[model samples]
Target: MEASRQTSPPDSISQDVNPVFFQQLRDLDIPEEAAKQALLHTGNVSAEEAAMYYFNKLENEEADGDLMYKMVFVVNMDLAMGVGKIAAQVGHAAVGLYQALQDKNSWREMAWKWDHSGAKKIVVQGTSVAHLLELQAQAMSLNLPTYLVQDAGLTQVASGSRTVLAVMGEEDIVNNVTGSLKLL
Candidate 1:
């Protein structure tokens, strides 16, 4: 007598977040960064403004290649589920997949590895990209490679994949990579 309802898988839902959502995420980052500067200027910066300021600093430095791409590891359960489902659908080994789901650090490490392997350039994403840039600058001051992965774009495509991580090199070039990531 009762009708049944099915729950949609998480990946299906996550993939639906369009370039517009990415743009909003970028837009929201500005105020968040400013608030953070306001806070640090006083006490606590809003998430958005803090992110924007960091992004700007990275921009001004003219850091290029993998140092300019925006790469993010989806550690959140809801977020990772989408990627997990895709892997599952593709028939990767079950144990390896399960381990990936369970270990956030391992997942991040794997993502980083994939990022640096083939491409000299990398892109970063997520709420943490700005914070990561701060650390990158510090490392740069130490005469080390900051490896700042810049945001490519929401709708743009470089390789066959659409992950935020767009690898760049001397041969492959594009201007205003982050131009697409920020709010107009």
Candidate 2:
């Protein structure tokens, strides 16, 4: 005789998330779990998704507010992209920026004591500009120059504009004067 089934099915909690948001996040390479969690908790999709959504919303409405910058610096990757995208903006504003090539000790040195001497330029090899900016803002109350170089590995600076690039590979980026660097 066949045994009677007694297993309970998994609970079906239909999350109140927009399907379009899911599609957008998926297209942006965001993992499903992270995207769902971000949407549930933050009331948005992935960081990139949320940023883009807000940015577009603002643009469509012709908004001129502080949140504009807030949208671009959403994720670490986004920040890195932004740094690469805005290196010229930072430089034009006269903020000095630097990126790491292949030194650990030098990077640590810069992270430790760049702001104490009023340095304003910083370089991040792997991390995004958002992470760097967050760190810099936390470290010192002063605004510093920010730059990001793609193809670098996991790098971070908790403070200072003179922080070195904690690089494990080649610098990759050549010209920092313009935003022509590949931002992957």
Candidate 3:
């Protein structure tokens, strides 16, 4: 009699998620349950598309008291930038990204949460311009705010050099992008 019975997981838990797609979103630090919901809600579309939808959905949802936000600066290691130069670049990235968030109500809310949560910040080393761009792309795909700093010729780096990439969002989501990189 038991062998004839059919059962399924709870409705809240999606069973049809694509493993590869799930892992991609997971790599971006989305919670396991949220990733499953994204896959289910988006009908298992491409990972990038699902991630974008998940974050966009978050932007419209009511703020949660426990949500943690953070900011990360990825310095261009290839530039051979001095400590002082790196400091200036990171400063620029922080202020610029902060200003960018003010334009969006949801982002402003996230920023407020971050500010009240000790405004956690991390500095990480990026291999090159390509690496920075790749990380920026991943962040953007997940709807995270990014600000890339460009150096002027008068400074230590060449004019138009991509100096730093700053990404801001929920702590875990932000970690999905820069967590693998080494600390600066």
Candidate 4:
């Protein structure tokens, strides 16, 4: 898959990438960012090994194309929020998750990939606050970044009500977490 890699390091891996292996990867026609990530993930392993990992990731559509990453907003249907309120809550969840991801090394990379890969977002419904928490837990266990948006009392929901949960990760893994939920 084609990738317009950013100049910034992938996954915040600031260490210098091995020049020789990088060349080898480029020789193999792998995208620069994907090559860098493959090298980072495989450590000091040889070019062959890193290339294998890269191809495998691509085969799984976890590399840089298709639905590589996505952000999911799960709204608490239990709340009696107006359409505007739900929109506001989802907006809050998106901004909150983004702010939170900036400080995270790996998650920041996911954000970059998501932004480049169409920034797919799905708004789904949750039964209640408890259900949101359960989904958040499931997402976290898979190493995905999650943000649960709590409402301020001035809004439709009561103060500290879990109005939305924003989860970001690889599309397939995220599917395992909230794929069953009905769309909002």
What TM-score would each prediction reach against the true structure?
Answer: 0.21, 0.21, 0.65, 0.65
lDDT of each: 0.33, 0.37, 0.88, 0.86
Candidate ranking (lDDT, best to worst): 3, 4, 2, 1
After TM-score superposition, what is the CA distance of residue 7 in candidate 4 from its true location, in Å? 34
Worst 10 residues of 3 by lDDT: 6-15
lDDT of 3 by residue, 13-86 (tens): 45588778998998999877678777877889889888998787677554543677889999999999999999
lDDT of 3: 0.88
Task: Report the Cα lDDT for candidate 1.
Answer: 0.33
Please provide, for model 2 over 1-184, each residue's C-alpha lDDT reduced to its tens digit, 9 standing for 90 to 100: 9989854435332346555676676677755643454455557545565646544644654653311110011123343334454453334223223333113565434433332222323332425555545444432232222332232333442232332222111112212221232332
lDDT of 1 at 104: 61
Candidate 1 lDDT by residue in tens digits, 27-113: 655433233333343222343444454466546545543332222221112122254443332232222333443346644543453
TM-score, candidate 2, is 0.21
**Model 4: residues >4 Å from true position, as ranges?**
1-67
Worst 10 residues of 2 by lDDT: 66-75
Q: Assess the local accuracy of residue 61 in candidate 3 as a C-alpha lDDT between 0 and 100.
A: 53
lDDT of 4 by residue, 73-114 (tens): 999999979999999999999999999999878877778878
